[model samples]
Target: MASPTAAPALRAEHLTKHFGRTHAVEDLTLEVAAGEVFGFLGPNGAGKSTTIRVLLGLLRPTAGTAWVFDAPAADVERAHRYLAHVPADVALWPSFTGQECLDLLAGVGPGTDLVYRAELVERFGLDPGKRARAYSTGNRQKVALVAAFATRAPLLVLDEPTSGLDPLMEREFRRCIAEATGRGQTVFLSSHQLAEVEAVCTRVGILRAGRLVEVAGLAELRRLRRSEVAVELARPQPALDALAGLPGVADVRWTSPLELTLALTGPPGPVLRALGDADVVRLDVREPSLEEIFLDYYGQAAA
Candidate 1:
């Protein structure tokens, strides 16, 4: 359990970063509480990576400040003691075997749990005997993930951590994230995979072209959007005509003699009331996918 007054695991105050004349990240202010898994979302050129670099103290923010565990991020020695990180890609020493690389990473970071490292090695299906030169992209990624997960560090910063992983390995990664949160570790994830983020994140922060445009919980974002619905009836009931005029219903279309699809926003009460007396053989409602919710925000920003 996190104390209500606990210092944030990560914080940035009106943070901005620029390269020459181009502003990569601008006026970003955010806070992530202890033990929370936050998803950082953006497309290419959206400044997601730049923001991460500032948070890691790899790049000095052109303006504002970022802190980790209440230590200024620029002071790497003090701030880094509490975190472990795995970037989108990792290149290991050609001569070292996976085990050796893990050992080296562990040594350089805070103390790691050797026992848990062994377990993670097994869970991720990584073979430690292979030298880095023989490893594929996915294998190299595994080495980094295993090291980060096994560390007892309180914060894990992962950027596209599942890049080269197969679907099966992606499942395993999600499991690892669950365990991390269970142990009260905060996770800052930057990824392009909507499904993965939707699976493990408690909240999502969306960045659009170097700016923070929207930040909200998944359910809250969903509430602001519409749902796709398909309905099947025993017959072509006349109630369908009435539903077209009902509040929060639009795009009513007949796909077949017995089936119809429509977009519904807000409460389903009006639609349900209209269908109350009809022979509804089947009705299915699907909340918008994460990609759809994301676009809704982007669309708002663009307009």
Candidate 2:
């Protein structure tokens, strides 16, 4: 369990980064609490990678500060002692075998549980005897993931770690993250996979055009989503002018003389009452998925 008095695992205060005339990340401020799994989300070109580079001390911030385990990010050597990082792209010396790569990373990282590392290698279905040059993209990713998960560092920073993984491997990745958090390790997960984030993160932050647009728990975000509703009338339906005017109803359309489809965004009371007046034969309400909600945010940002 994380100590209540322990400082946050990661913190950014008014952080910004720029390249020539372009602002990559602008005035971003957020904190990842000890033992928290935070999802950092953004569309491509939204500064997610830039913000991470600053946090890793690979790039000096144009303004403000980033800290890891209470040490300034600029002090990479010290700050890195408390964390393990897995980048979107994994590169390895072509001559080294998978086992050799794991050994090398463990030797340089904070610390490693060799026993657990062995288990991860098996679970990820990696052939440790293969040389790096022969490994496929997914297999190379597995090597990096295994190395990071085997570490005893208090924080894990993953940037699109599952990009090369197949569905089964992605599930294994989520399981590993769960186990890490269970051991009181903090996780900063930057991913474009909304379903993955929805499955694992305790909270999520959405970024757009170098700015932090919103930060909220999954449940809170779900509340803002619209539900898809399809209703079938048993008989010729009454005109739906009143239903169209209902507070939360939108995109009302009659697909056929007996069927109506609409989107519901808020309280269902009024809409339900209006539906009750019709000769309702069947009704289906499907909740919006995380991907839909994410796209909604992106669309709104674009507009």
Candidate 3:
């Protein structure tokens, strides 16, 4: 495990990156703590990949600054020593075998556990003897994952790391993330998959277009979004106006004379009690998914 440091794993202060008239990443400020999995959530073309490239020193920030373990992001030689990265689309030397590629990476990177790398290779179901030229997209991704997971670097930056993997492979990816954290490594994950982000990330920062619109813990985010509740009654509900007036009920829809569905935010207790004596034949409550939550909050921000 890499030694713990007081500095955050990553920091961006009013960072901006632009291409001609287009702004790829604009005025972004964020921080990721050491030893925590922080999800960078955004859709494709939302500047996630651009932001990552700047952080990796592959592209210079047009303004502001970025840091890795207190080392300047533009100082790749120095900053990279403290972190390992896996890109969304991985490319390898076609002539080299998967094992050879892993070996070359370990040779150039900070350090690696050959034993752990061997295990990861098996777990990810990679054929190490196969030449990279013959490997499929998923196999190439697996090689990158294996290399990053086995590294002793303090921080790992993963961009859409599970893009081409199977469901079972995705599960293994989650397990690898858990093990990385257990070893005290910080992870900065860039992805748009809400379920994937929710599975391992404690906190997420949502980016829309080129701007960051929201940042919050998973629990906090869920609490701030609306939930859907559907209730069917034996008879038409009386005092419909009164139920709509209840606190936390944002929207009330009468699907039929006897059915009431509501968009609710905050505590459900108030909404539940308001349904008393309606002879509810069916009741269902559904929490807002992260995608729905994103639209509810940042859809306007995009405009």
Candidate 4:
């Protein structure tokens, strides 16, 4: 097991991939430190898969390069010793049983460790004798997940790894990830589940239109965006509409005779004072959701 330390497990420098005239990933640069789970998030057609393929050496980059544990992705034998990848649709031989698939994956390397094999079967609730064809998509994914996690590999790249999993299985996946990080393993998780990313990743990069739109810690990203503050006033004063034009207030809406919703972008102090002067029954302040944040970014990108 690698010591939990501050070294980059993966690094991409000015990586660009093009499919004809279309740019799939443009000048993308990022790093995943050892023992950290760096979440890659984007909407459909955002080049998440393209970037993963480049990292896994499944595709060659048009420009720049990607490194797995300081070695080029093109070196399969070297990468096999240090990194593992789990795809969205995990494929296994239908004729074989779950245990057979596990054995084959373990045979990939002489240094492979199966110490966690029995524990993972029980943990993920997988039956070893079940035929691969009989297993659900989630079960097949579990087989891949268990195989990747049971190894001593320093890096694990998972693209939509939990797509077919149910809630219970998702929880188990998260638990397994948490345990892996504790053992100093690095995980590069590409997922649409922002809540999951928010829960597990220490840092994240947002992709839009094949470009890196933003990269920041979760807390920092939240601070840069405005939250919606809804207030139910005890009295009505249409004059409060004046606050709409103030700085840091993006928009405002009147829900009823006394309820109003305001988009606040700055410190809440000034907004709170304005509400106090207007009189209110109760107030609610909520940070914008990940979806909302992305939508706002999209709007800006379009404009």
Which candidate number has the best TM-score?
3
Clashing pairs in 1: none
lDDT of each: 0.90, 0.90, 0.90, 0.84
TM-score of 4: 0.89
Off by over 4 Å in 4: 3-6, 109-113, 237-242, 276-278, 299-303
Clashes of 2: 0
Instruction: Tell how far residue 11 is off in model 2, in angstroms.
Output: 1.5
Candidate 1: TM-score? 0.90
Q: Which residue pairs in candidate 3 have backbone atoms (N, alpha carbon, C) closer than 3 angstroms, thus clashing?
A: none
Residue-level lDDT for 149 in candidate 1: 93
Q: How far is candidate 3 from the true structure (C-alpha RMSD, Å)?
A: 1.8
Q: How many backbone clashes does candidate 3 have?
A: 0
Candidate 1 on 1-303: residue-level lDDT in tens?
Answer: 232237898999999998999999999999988999999998777998889999989999999999987789999988888899998778899999999999999998877989999999999999999999999999999999999999988899998899999999999999999999999999999988899999999999999888998789989888778899899999788657777888888999999989999999899988888888889999999999889988777787789
Assess every candidate by TM-score: 0.90, 0.90, 0.93, 0.89
lDDT of 4 by residue, 1-303 (tens): 462235588888999999999999999998878878888998878999999998777899999888777678788677657877898779999999999999998888423566777899898899989999999998999999998888778888899999988888889889989988987888999998887887888888899988998888877788789888888887888888888877798778888988889888868887777767777778899987666776778889889
Model 2 scores a C-alpha lDDT of 0.90
> Residues 1-303, candidate 2, lDDT per residue (tens digit)?
223247889899999998989999999999889988999999888999889999989899999999987789999998888889998889988999999999999999989999999999999999999999999999999999999999998999999999999999999999999999999999999999999999999999998889998888888877788888899988877676568888888999889989989988887888888877788899999988778888988888678
Q: Show the lowest summed lDDT stretch of 10 residues, model 2.
A: 1-10
